[model samples]
Structures are given as C-alpha cells and as structure tokens.
Target chain A: MSTTKYFAPSVEYAAKILIYLSRYKSKQSTLTEISKNLDINKSACLRVLKTLEANNFVYYNSETKKYSLGTYISVLGKRVGENLDYLRIINQFLEEVCELTGLTAALVQRVSFDRVMFISQYQTQIQPRLSISVGNRFPLTEVSYGKWILANVSEEERNYHLREGLKKVTSYTRTNLQKYIDELSEIKRSNILVSRQEYTNNVTAISSALYDWKGQILGMIALVGVSSLIDEAEEQRLCTVLKEVTNRCNEHLIQLKIEAYEFPYESKITQ
Target chain B: MSTTKYFAPSVEYAAKILIYLSRYKSKQSTLTEISKNLDINKSACLRVLKTLEANNFVYYNSETKKYSLGTYISVLGKRVGENLDYLRIINQFLEEVCELTGLTAALVQRVSFDRVMFISQYQTQIQPRLSISVGNRFPLTEVSYGKWILANVSEEERNYHLREGLKKVTSYTRTNLQKYIDELSEIKRSNILVSRQEYTNNVTAISSALYDWKGQILGMIALVGVSSLIDEAEEQRLCTVLKEVTNRCNEHLIQLKIEAYEFPYESKITQ
Candidate 1:
C-alpha cells in the first residue's frame, strides 16, 4: 500500500506465470515451455514454479512433467467471492437484469487505469447467446463499460487513456474524437452507455457505472447481446433498466459505505 | 517444478501474503500488521505487495493505507473454476446429492499430503443445514472424507499421517487404532464411509472417494447433516444414494482421463 511503486521481480514473474497457466489451463506446460514462453530466466522461473507448486498455487503433474493452476487458486477465489459485499450485491443486481431481459449480464471490474476485466457473468438459457466468460479483459477506450469508465475519470486522465489512437473495432466503431467526447459527456449526464456493435460485430451493449460513496467509479454493470435481437424499443427498455439497477446498486453501496469494505468470507446457509 | 525444492523466497512471501489477505479478507491490514504477522521482512513485504497491487493481486486502499486481495484474484479464481472439468462434474453431482438427500453435500479436494479443503458445497433449502463453507481446510486424518483418504492410502503412508495420533474429538471418536483399521477395511469393501458424530458432536456424515483413471483416490464426495435428522432407514438410503452417485462420478472421471486434465475455461451457454 505504499505511495511509491516498487515491484519485486520474483513476485511479478510468479504472477505472470500463474496467469499464463490460467490462460492456457487446458494445456499443462513443462518448466522449459513456461520459462521460455514467459521470457523469464530458466532457473529463476523454475524456482518460482517450484515455490508455487509447494504452495498449491500451481499443480505439478509428475507423470507428465508439466504444471497447471493448483487448488489454492480456486480456494483463494472462493474466499474472495464470498468476502466482497459490493461484488455480491452487484452480482445479485446483474442476475435480476439477466433474468428480466433474457440477455447476458456481466460485472466488470476496473483492474488498472486503462484496463478492466469481467469478474462475474450471468448468461441467459437461450441458444446462440453471448459466450463471454469471466477474466476477459478489455481496454478502457473500448466497449460500453469502457465509455462509462472514461466518462467518470478526470479530464487529464481521460485524455491520457485516449492518447493511444482509437481502435476501429468494427465498421460501427466510433473513431471520431469529437463524437466520442460528446458521447462521454452524454454518459456523464445520463449515467448510461448504449453501443451498437461498437466493439464487437453484431453485439449491442448497454452499461451503467457503479460509484462509491465519493462518486468515484468503481466499475460498471453491462448487458450484452446480438444487435439484431435488440430492437429500438428493446434498447430503450434495456437502457432504462440498467440505469435503475446501477443507481440502486450505487445507493446501496454508498449507504453501506466503508463497512462494505469488510467482505465476509463465510457463505451463510439460506433457510 | 524441480525434483529438488528451491523456493524463491520472494514468491513464497507473496503467496503467503495473498493467502493471509484471503484468510482475513474482511479486515484491511496495514503493511506493518501484515509484515509482522506473517513474519515477512517489512521492505521485502512492501515490494511484494506493491508488485501484487500492480498486477491487481492485492488492492491497496490509499486512504486507509491498508491492503486486501485484489480483483485479479477473483479473475484467476473464476478462470480456474471454469478450466477445471473435475471440479465442474463433481459440483454437478454434489448438487444432485444435496437435492436428493436434503443434506449439505461438499466436494473436498486433497491439497497436500496431510491437508484437504472444501473446494465447493451445495446446501439444501431445509433449515438448520450444515454451515460449512468453501476454503475450510481439515487435516487429512479428520472428518468423514479424511477417513476415506486414510482408507485409500498405503498402510505406511496412513500410519505416518496418524503418527501425530488422533485427538479424541468426542466420546464417539474412535481412538482405538485396531478398530479404526478394521473400519477402514470395511470402507475398502463398501467404498462408502459412514461416521456417526465422530468428528463433530451431533453431526452424521457419509462420504465416498472419487478416483482418477489410475484408480488413485483423488478426493471425496460427502453428505453431512445432523445425526438426529438422519434416522436408521434414512442413513441406509443415504448410503445407497451416495454410493450410486459417487460410482457414476468415478466412472465418468475415468473415461475423461487425460483430456479431463484440460479444463475448458469457457462458460458455455446452456440452452
């Protein structure tokens, strides 16, 4: 929690290795493959992998002479999932949105200044539904949630994020700086974003920002589906619902305030 | 992973810190508190924490000057949950057990030689259900699953586990090694474990080992409830059902074999 950033190289390598394993979890990798692919020194990566294996962060398959993510990652994940109240609350709200709209609902968390990742998602029991999974990361300048994020940050920060040229993700992607800025201003006013195949083809997304007590954007809740499935009337209804759900979520979070910071790790038995 | 254990101290400290954060997730701990409690050197801990923060493994509260497990932990956790096929299959089977038996059903994973943790659980809607949560660890020599684990291991390995000797949990606890070995033999024949208030008072548990294609005991599936609620007839019925469910699970797992090693990380849409 230091103000000045100081990274431990070994720690960074370990995190990278764990993430690499998670990314290609279906493939168990040898020490040589992992060390080479991640560009870490062979002996150093081996030491970290060995340490991870001992801690159960990565599982070692002795017979195959390879490694995969171990039990501890899931253990830590379950603990975190149970502990975070805001996450739980947002998830409940997202479920409601998913059920009502019969679309895919996802809770995305801003991981860094320019990056956000889907932490949890609820998909409809409908054929040809969106196949987005948790852990998928997107840039702050792309996607509906990204606009909500850009709409809330300070002007300087916003410009810095956009300093990188806009990506034309699809034919429908908005690349004009002025129009994008205007939309962000609109998002700031209405607290909702509506994108018609802006990031991905045939996908329409509506998103609303979740705010802490200080009005800082924590993250965003989004509803995504194929654009063809969402008519003009449907998009309006979706936007309205997202705004209300996010508003209620933000209000509840504000009232919970700092106490919400204390995430209870226990899963209560529901009678 | 190497044959000779060469732990990267910094990596070890990072894992320990993250686990500690998960253990006391409800509390945001200052650097001094974390460093002192985990016995990690202050500067070394700070560097690791900073690195973790950069990777979103730990969240740093600038205002409070404290730390908590960050967004990336949940991201990794979700990916692991999705990627592990055995976990998904077992969870599905546990859900069936909970519904059919109206008891708390849990999928326990062997984390180490002498330790196992509840990776997932399904509880019935009935009142007074067992309140065990995921991430709760138990010694491999305790609980119904522990008994199953003991029964599956080699006699020498089992003896080593019991070397510390069993602490009599209750009057019902079987402290006699002779009787315990006889029961383990019975378990080997039956492939089912029935413990009546042995580990915790007034708790009855039925467990069956899950096996890999190699026929090694991977972990266990356990049904738990209050002793009084499980009448004689109910216990017999429960035992029969658990045996059937676990048998099907084991058969399916054996068929899965090495391909099961590759966990699909995608959340497929259920139509």
Candidate 2:
C-alpha cells in the first residue's frame, strides 16, 4: 500500500498563493506576473491559482486573463473577526460610545512606526462620520491613537521613535528631539492624548491606551468625530466614559489572564 | 547603480505572512509549523515571520516559542473597513433595513458551501442577538443565502446541483428528487426563498439574489432575525423593504454596466 501526503503539500502551496494575492489585492496580476513575483515556476503558480479560484479565494477575469482577490477573501476576514472574539467583546461598547459622543470609535493597534492598523469601528449616526476602514494604516504621529501610544512610551524611547516614525507622515509633525522628550513627560502626567484636527481638518480625536494582562501596551481605542461635536464639556464627558471603559476592559483582560499596563502618570486631580 | 528592490519584495513577503497569520490567528504556531503549513522553506519562513514581528503583524511568545497574530491585524481590518468605499455603499442601506425591521441585516457574498463571508452587519439590539460573525460558513441548503442561490440555477443545472449539493448538508435537507424540482420551480416563480427555522430553531431568513453588471449572480443579501420578530405582517413589510433596497442596489449595478437576472416567478395570489 502506498500512502501519499498530497493534501498538505497542495494546501501549503495554496496558502502561499493566498498570501501573495492579499498583498496585490488592489492590483490584478496574471499567472506569469505571479510566477515572476514569487520566483516560482509558472506551472506551480497556475496550479495554485486554479485551486484558489475553485475555493473562491481568487478569481480570474476571463477577459483580461488577470487575477484578483475573490469575494471570499472578505469572508476570510469575517472569520478572523469572529475567531478573535472582537465582535463579542467590543461591539456594544463601541456602539454606546458612538451614540453618546456622536463620534466614530476606532480601534487601532500599532503595525509600524508610521502605520497603525484599524481593526473595527462604530460610526456616529450622523452625516460625515469619520471615514476609515478595517485593514487600513495611518501614521502613528498624525492621529489620536498615535499620540496615545506615544504618551505611553518611555522618555528615552520617545526621541528615537519620533525621529524614525514621524519622518514621513506630516510636515507639521514634531521632530525636535528635546520637544518630544518634554511632550512624552507631559503626556505621562496627563494619561490622555488629544489630537485637535491633527489627522484631518475639523476632525478631533481623544484616545487612551489599552493594555494586555502582562502590562504591555496593546493598542489605543479612540473616539473621533467632527470638532463641532466635541466641545470642552463634551470632551471631558467622553474622557470619563472612555476611562471607565478602558478600566473595565482592563479588568476583563485580567480575568482572561492577560497582563495589564498601568498609566505612567496617574493623577487624581484630573478625574 | 545598484537599485535595491529590497523594500518592495520584503513588503510583499511581509504582507503574505500577515495573510497567512490571519488564518491561524488564535493558535500560536512555531516557525517550522508555519513553514510547513505555508510550504515555504523553513529558513524563508523565519525571515518572513521576523519581518512580520518587526512590523507587529505577529507577536512571538518567547516562553512558548510560537507566534500568534498581534493586535495589529485587527487594527488593519478596521482600517480596511474605513477605507473601502464599497462597504460604505452597502452599509447605508443595511442600517436602514435593520432599523425598519428590527432584525439582523447582513451583506454576504458566497465563498463556498462551507462558508459565507459577511462584509457588514447591523446586529439586533436585543440580548443574544443572532450570533453571526463576519466570516462564517453554513451548509448552502440550510440557510437563506443557499436557497436563494439554489433558485438561480437553470432547469437542467438545478437538477444536477440538487443531486450533488443537497444530499450532503442535512438529512431533512431538500434532496427529494421530485420535490426539489418542484421547489426550484416554485422559487423561480416567486423570486424569493424563505428558510423558516431551517438553519436554527426560532430563526427565519428571506433572501433575494443579487447580480453584477455582467448579469452574473454576485451573491444573495438576506434579512435574518428571530422568528418571533418576523410575524406574517412584519415579514411582508420586511420583504417589501428588502425588494426596494435590492432594487436600489441593482440600479447602482446597472450604472456600473451590470445587468440583473430577471426573476421568473410572479407574485402569488394566495398571500
């Protein structure tokens, strides 16, 4: 009896092709193009593409003879959200925040220095909700999430990150070595970061850092809306709610045995 | 002149790793496991994972010596939602349907028999709101989307499909040779299919097919909610709304030069 391990090998190849397709989602590619890009043989690429097409992971445009992500790729994303428990944990709180503040609630995690990835959002039930998307990236220094992350960074690490991270994002982006050091100190004192239309005109965001059980800064959850919707009073009210939610989430994390990070600058006066 | 395409290729590889990690998100996998799963060389997989770790697409657990998807992945998904224009188009109408009918509204594209990916959803406000995830799959014959899709097959093709597709899902699944022929005929006559507690007890769904500008069935959009919420009068109202919204969506498709399939079924006089 001869036993062949064919499924694993083919599944592996299929996985690679899927990875490649995800990178070139906006730009369609042909078999030859994929072959050349991945440096794999043409036949192997063709085989992988065929399998993906069958599974609805990739689609071939018969007219152009090019390939793009199939509609099913979005389905894969939906599975990711479900498996990660994001929908269960965050949905209601996000809706409440959006309802109370009339601002979009965005959850962002740091991906790279100038890029933070958006995970989920609850949009305000009004015209011109802050437009953003899942799997999109934003500069860490140009948005509330970026500032919130920076506020949690150590003093020594702040300068290095600012120089390397904020270089490409904004012309008005702060680059002064000493200024960043001082700003981090101030943020540490405040335990909150406010960006007044930093990312876009008339869009303001207030963000606080979220922690895992191990005390690592996991990400930032921000409440963003038009500046007109968030005056000083409204901002303060949002801050209170945001703080409470963060605290509750922290407790949830602890219950799950994830470590929680403490705010560096804790002040009873602000509360 | 030595031009380094280092960043582009690495970025591409890194993106692939991100997508790969997306599949095995909750369970940490070692470098060897990932290489074997992706069918890349062990050394190459390590390099890709390193770059992903550096970019925060993955996090390495030192103690376990395995890697899990970092918080950054969720962040990226959120950003993708914010930036994707097509989602916004569907979301506007999805919200209205949810509000009018007080049921969960879903925009889904068929992935496979095992999966139907959710793009966007307006979940019911009630506790224990139908637990549907963005990316999940169900047997085609047991769900609203499946019935609607099944109704789209041509006469001869429909028979072949039932023989192959219907036998696998459920024992109570409509695999009766004559009954299936008649069911498809009825669906063709009515243009809408209803699954009354077929997938889950006390849950009902009514779905209509959607087409692209090219007249291909893109997928089906279904209104799903508890059976109690969709009484006969409410069901009629919700179906009217679904028809209107689907028509509006079809108009958008036509503007893009897409043609919709004409429904063969006429309104029944009994109702």
Cα-based lDDT for every prediction: 0.78, 0.59
> In candidate 2, residue B111 scores what lDDT?
57
Estimate candidate 2's alpha-carbon lDDT, on a 0 to 1 scale.
0.59
Query: What TM-score would candidate 2 get against the native?
Result: 0.60
Instruction: Provide C-alpha RMSD values for all models, in order.
Output: 8.2, 10.9
lDDT by residue (tens digit), candidate 2, B189-259: 66566777755667787776667666666666678877876779888887888878877876675564432
Of candidate 1 chain A, the 10-residue stretch with the lowest lDDT total is A262-271
The pairs that clash in candidate 1 are B83-B263
iRMSD in angstroms, per model: 4.6, 9.6
- Candidate 2 regions exceeding 4 Å error are A1-106, A117-136, A141-175, A185-190, A194-207, A213-215, A221-271, B1-108, B113-134, B147-175, B194-204, B223-251, B254-271
